[model samples]
Target: MSQTIDNRQFRLARRPKGLPERDDFDLVTEPLAEAKDGEVRVAIDYISLDPAMRGWMNAGKSYIKPVGIGEVMRAGAAGTVIDSKHPDFAAGDKVSGNLGVQTHAVFPGDELRKVDTSLADLPVYLGALGMPGMTAYFGTLDVGQLAEGDVVLVSAASGAVGALVGQIAKKKGASRVVGIAGGPEKCRYVVDELGFDGVIDYKNEEINDAVRRECPDGIDLYFDNVGGEILDAALANLRLHARVAICGAISQYNVTGNVGDTGYAPRNYLSLLINRARMEGFIVFDFADRYPEAAREMAAWLSAGELKHREDIVEGFDTFPDTLLKLFTGENFGKLVLAVER
Candidate 1:
C-alpha cells in the first residue's frame, strides 16, 4: 500500500478586528497532494511569526495585498522538499519562502530557495538568517545611511531585527548604540548580551526623557521598529541631518479602532524641520537581489561572534492562532517561529 500523508493549514476565516482572535483563523486538514510537473512538495518544518503579519490581515491596500478571507495565512517558512518535478529542485532539499501557515504544500519550484542546514539551523534561517536579518542589514546601512562614530538608537531593541540593528550599528563603528526595549529584562539583555552601549526600559521610564538622556549628544541615526510614542521620542533627539529608518511600527499593529484615530502620530514633526533630518521606510523585498551578499557578510559576523541572534520557537501547528497572538503580547522573546513539524 502507498503511504498516506496529511496536510494541515491555518487559513484566514475572517479579518481580525484587533489582535487576531481564534475565530479569525480556521485549522483544516486534508490529504497531501502529489507534486505535479514543474512543482515540488515541501514538508514544512517551521513557520515565521512576524509583527508585519498583522498589517497583512487588514482589509485594504498596502505594500502587499491583504490576505483575503479563506486563503492560507501568508508566512515565510522553511522545510524539506520531499518530492520534486522541477529541474532546479530535488527530493530532500531544504528550502524557504512564502510557504504559508501549513505543514505541507505543493508549489512551483521557483517559489522556493534552497537552504543549507550546515550553514544554519532551519529555524535560525527563519530568524537571523532570514527576512529579519535582511531587514536589519539594509535598513541600517542603506536606508539609515549610517556613519562611523555616529550615535545610533534602535527601538524594539531585543527583538529579532532590532537586536541585530543595534549590533550592526556598533560593528559598523557607531560611537554609541542605545536600544529602547520594553521592561528591565529585555533592556539588560540588549545591553549586556547584545553589546548595546546603553538601553532604555521603555515600559517604565518616560520615553522622551530616556531618549534625551541616552542620546544627549543627539541621535545621528534612529532605526525605529516600534513607532508611536517611541518615534516621537527619537524625533525629539535628532541631530542635524540625522537619518531615521522606519523599519516597522509594531506598537500600532493591534489597534482595533481606526488606525488614524490612535492619536499616536508624531507630534514632533517640527524637529525634522529644525534638524533637517531624513526619514525613509523600506521593505526587505526591495533589496531581494542583494540578499545573498548581505547574508554572506552576516554569516561571517555570526561565525566571528560579533553578531548575536535569538529566537522564540513554539511547537504545535494546532496552536498557530494562540502562538501568533504571542507576537502582539511580547510573550515570545527573540525571533518568533513555529515548529510546524511537531
Candidate 2:
C-alpha cells in the first residue's frame, strides 16, 4: 500500500525589505504522494537558516535563480528517507540535500548525500559539516590562499561560516586570528571559546579603528562575511600580497528602497594595487566534486576535537518566518536550525 503524508511548507508570500517580517511567508499544509523514479521521499528533520537565503528572495541576478513568488522558500535540509525508488538509497537512510522549507521532500537521489550518523548530529550536517563548513574551507584555502603564519581576519566571526573560518585558519598555523562581531558576548565567544587571537565588537568601536588596533601589522587574509563598511576597513589594512575572500555581504541585505550608491565604497582601493592583493567571491556549490574530501577532513577534525560547532535550534515549523529574522538581527548564535519534527 502507498503511504500518504501531510506536509507543511512555507512559501514566499512577498518580497521583503530590510528585516523580513512574518507576512513574507505563508504556511500551508498539503498532501504528498509517493516518490517517483530515481527519487526518495524524505521526512525533513532539520532545516538550515542561512544569511544567504535573504539574497535568494530578491528578484535579481545571482549565482542561482530567485525563488518565484508562489514557490517554496529555498533551503538546505536533512532528514530520513521514508521511501525510495532510487537504487542507491533505501528506506530509513539519512540524507541531506537542498530540500527547501517543507516537512516532506521528494529529493532526487543524485542530489542527496548519505550521512553517517556516527560522525555528528543531523544539525551538524546542515551546518559545520554541510554548506557552511564547505564554504569556510574552500573560501579560505582556495580563494584566500591561506598559508602558515599568515594573519587572518574574519567579519561576522560568530556566525556559522565565520566561526569555522577562524578555527580552520588557526589549525593551518595562522599567527593571529582576529574576528569582528556585533556585540561583547559574540566577541568574547570568538576569542575566549573559539581560540581566536583577538576580537573587536563592531557595535561599540568604529570598523576601521577596530581593524587598526587588532591587526597592527596589516591583514594577510581577510575572509569577509559582512561586507560594506567592514570590507572597506579591511581593505585599508591589507598586508603585501594579501587575499580577500568575499564570502558574503550581510550588511546590505535589508535595504527597503533602492540600493543607493551611498553604500560603503572602499577608499583604499589603491591598497590592492600597492600590495598586489587579490579579491575573489565564491559559491560553495562550485566545489561539489570536492565535498567528500572536505567532509572527510572536517569529520576527522570533529572526531579529533580540533573542530568545534555550535547550533542555535529553534523549535516549531510554524515559526520559520520569525526564526529566519534571527540571522539578520544577530539574535541567532552559531549555526541556526529549525526543528520541524521530534
- Give Cα-based local distance difference scores for all models: 0.89, 0.90
Each model's TM-score, in the order given?
0.96, 0.96
| Ten contiguous residues minimizing lDDT sum, candidate 2 | 256-265
lDDT of 1 at 315: 87
Tens-digit per-residue lDDT, 1-342, candidate 1: 327788998899988887889999998998888888999999999999998888888887578888889999999999998889899999899999998999999888887889878868889889888999999999999999999999999998899999999988888999999998888889889988999999999889998898989999899999988889899989999999999999888878777523324447888978889999998889999999999999999988877777888888898888889999888777777999999754
Cα lDDT tens digits, model 2, 1-342, are 776789888999988877788888888889987788999999999999998898888876678888899899999999999999999999999999999999999889999989988889889999889999999999888888999999999998999999999999998889999999988899889998899999999999988898999999999999998778889899999999999998888777776422322255567778899999998889999998998899889999998988878999999888898899898788998999999965
Error of 2 at 267 (Å): 2.7
Cα-based lDDT at residue 116, candidate 1: 79
lDDT of prediction 2: 0.90
Candidate 1: global Cα-lDDT? Answer: 0.89
Please list all clashing residue pairs in model 2, or write none if there are none: 18-254
lDDT, model 1, position 302: 79
RMSD of each: 1.5, 1.6
